[model samples]
Target: MNDIFSVLPDLGNFLVGYVTLTGVCSLRLFMVMFIFPPTADGLLQGVVRNAIVVLFSSYIAYGQPIAFIQTLRGITLIEVGLREALIGVALGYAASIVFWVAEGAGTYIDDLTGYNNVQVMNPSRSEQATPTATLLMQIASVAFWALGGMTFLLGTLYESYHWWPLTSSGPSMSNVLESFVLQQTDSLMQTIAKLAAPMMFILLLIDFGFGFASKSASKLDLMTLSQPVKGAVTVLMLALFVGVFVDQVKEQITLSGLTAEMRALSGGHQGKPD
Candidate 1:
């Protein structure tokens, strides 16, 4: 009885310390998983997903000393949690931009192909998307996995703790984040333009040819012919150029770029020694 009682206090303390540390470490991971793909589609409830992230993060963060709350009451805990979440969100946002660009390119192609009206709910994103858009998104997801992007992302997540420790004061990184976001947005537009350029040019040529044909034959209805003709040409062109498109996507979506972006968002500082 005496031995068990003596160990009980230590056990309780360990559990409390573990939970506290895990909660702190999990904040960033939870936010990243919440926003990033293959995990964000509401397939898992937020509470459940958060718990899984917490467990995973806790394992990764093991052996780190716990930073106990100075007070049980007040906003310090909330502030800390929010700050960690913000860091994760920043990283996830950068990662998601590649998918957004892919989808945008697909949407542009769909418009040119007269498939804009054939919209369906994208289960992955839970948004209305053209068939081509959804297909491209899936291709991006597959390529992301095949390229070892997830491993890179998880490694980056682990490194983030070294860069921005749980107990440290939040660094001023809003300006950095803003600048990165603006640069990424500009890059996204350029990427989409490049992806869709060849297809768009072909579609334009098709349109010009159809218009000339319509003018040459007054009674011929060009509207019906134009839609199907463009659709067929788009499908054929896409099949022929998919290799080029995927190669471009792979070039743009690099792990080094993502890691650099996340480091910038975290203010490029290493954690202080405990």
Candidate 2:
């Protein structure tokens, strides 16, 4: 009884130490997972999601050869956790941009095809989105997993510590934020344009043709007729173009560029990106 009682304090201390270490380590991870694929939407609610975060972050803390700061409690812990959270959110936002292109492309198509009025619950985005927009986003997410995107993302997170290790006073990624946001914006527009422009052009031509017919034969119900025609054509075009969209998505979520950025961050290379 004496031996068991004496060991209780030491065991409690050890558990506290592990929690502190993993808690700081998990900050960034929590931020990242909170945003993307497993916003754990729909069935994954509240405490369940948090438990998973704790579990995965615990795994991350143990799996990686992480370096710990000397005094990990009090305000220092809060600061470190905040820093990690910020970095994780930035990286998560960056990583999710590819999927946004997929979702955006669909939303654009829906807008062009007059389908944007209908909104449905999008589990992936964890918000109400148009049908086509939700479909495309879901497809892209599937492709993300099928093509090993999840692994790559987690790998980047794992390696990020090396770039801006928790103990490091300066989060070196701060300098690249502006340039990185610019890059993300440029990429988002270009990719969304590339994917949606073709469909938009087709929809515009259909609109023009219907408009011309209605103007010439002012008696006809082309306004009502236009809706059905556009809907069918939109379905057909989506089916035909979806394959191309998926193929492009295969390349978009490669995430190699993200890894490159992490490497650059670790190498102390911070400036306007090429």
Candidate 3:
């Protein structure tokens, strides 16, 4: 009984470390699904891909046997423990914000097209969303993964451990909260604008076209006929731009340098000293 009690701390630390890493990876994948438009190629490989991703992420966290052993040290338990969980949530939500651009844009489009009443049950979040919005979300998710979003996320997590190690001396709770809010608020709006800008531009053209058609055909009951026309245009535009959008997303993810930026943010905390 004495021996068991002595080892309990070590055991608890190891388990917590492992679970924290796993959960962070899972949350990353979840956020990607929520935010980005998925590519059609990924539709069939959905669950399998996520499983593989998590497995790979585990390797990233514990691949160093020595580090894994070090993480089992009973010191810094309380602080590191809480930090890991909060960081996981923060990273996950960041990804979600980026994805939400597609969701918000889709919602706006549906409302404009008179499809707001139709709802789709999204299995990912187990929530109801507009069908067009849901579809765009899925596509964005696929695009996120297809463009190596998992790699970027995992890289960010790894960088966190290296740059933001848990320390007995760290930032205050108020400081953490203030910095997090300020950082997220600044970036969230920018990310959403970047993702939605293209779609909104296209939609503006769509609106203009409809307006012109309506004016030219005064006797054709344009209001009633415009719905189908807009829907068709929306569908057509989405289909035509799917490939182009995916490529653009890939470029954006690369250019954004999310992994490096994440490291910088993590370092801002009482990270591990090199």
Candidate closest to the true structure, highest TM-score: 1
TM-score of each: 0.86, 0.85, 0.65
Per-residue lDDT over 83-144 for candidate 1, one digit per residue giving the tens place of the 0 to 100 score = 78888887777777878777898999898878899998877767789988887877777777
Q: Rank the candidates by lDDT, best first.
A: 1, 2, 3
Sorted on TM-score, best first, the list reads 1, 2, 3
TM-score for candidate 1, please give it: 0.86
lDDT of 1: 0.75
What is the lDDT, from 0 to 100, of the residue 53 in candidate 3? 54
Clashes of 1: 0
Q: Model 2's lDDT to the true fold?
A: 0.74
* lDDT for each residue of candidate 2 in 105-140, tens digit (9 for 90 to 100): 889988888888999999865679988888888777
What does candidate 2 score on TM?
A: 0.85
* Model 3 per-residue lDDT tens digits across residues 1-274: 9999999998998777677656543443444433333312235256765675576657655554446435533554444555555655555555455556667767877777778899988655657899878887777776666667756666665565555543324445466657876887777677656655666676667677767887898777666766787788778877976676566666444324666665555555553332
After superposing candidate 3 on the true structure, give the runs of residues whose Cα lies further than 4 Å from its correct spot: 1-78, 167-169, 197-220, 251-256, 267-274
- Report every candidate's CA lDDT: 0.75, 0.74, 0.61
Question: Candidate 2: which stretches are off by over 4 Å?
Answer: 1-10, 43-52, 63-70, 171-174, 254-257, 265-274
Alpha-carbon RMSD, candidate 3: 6.2
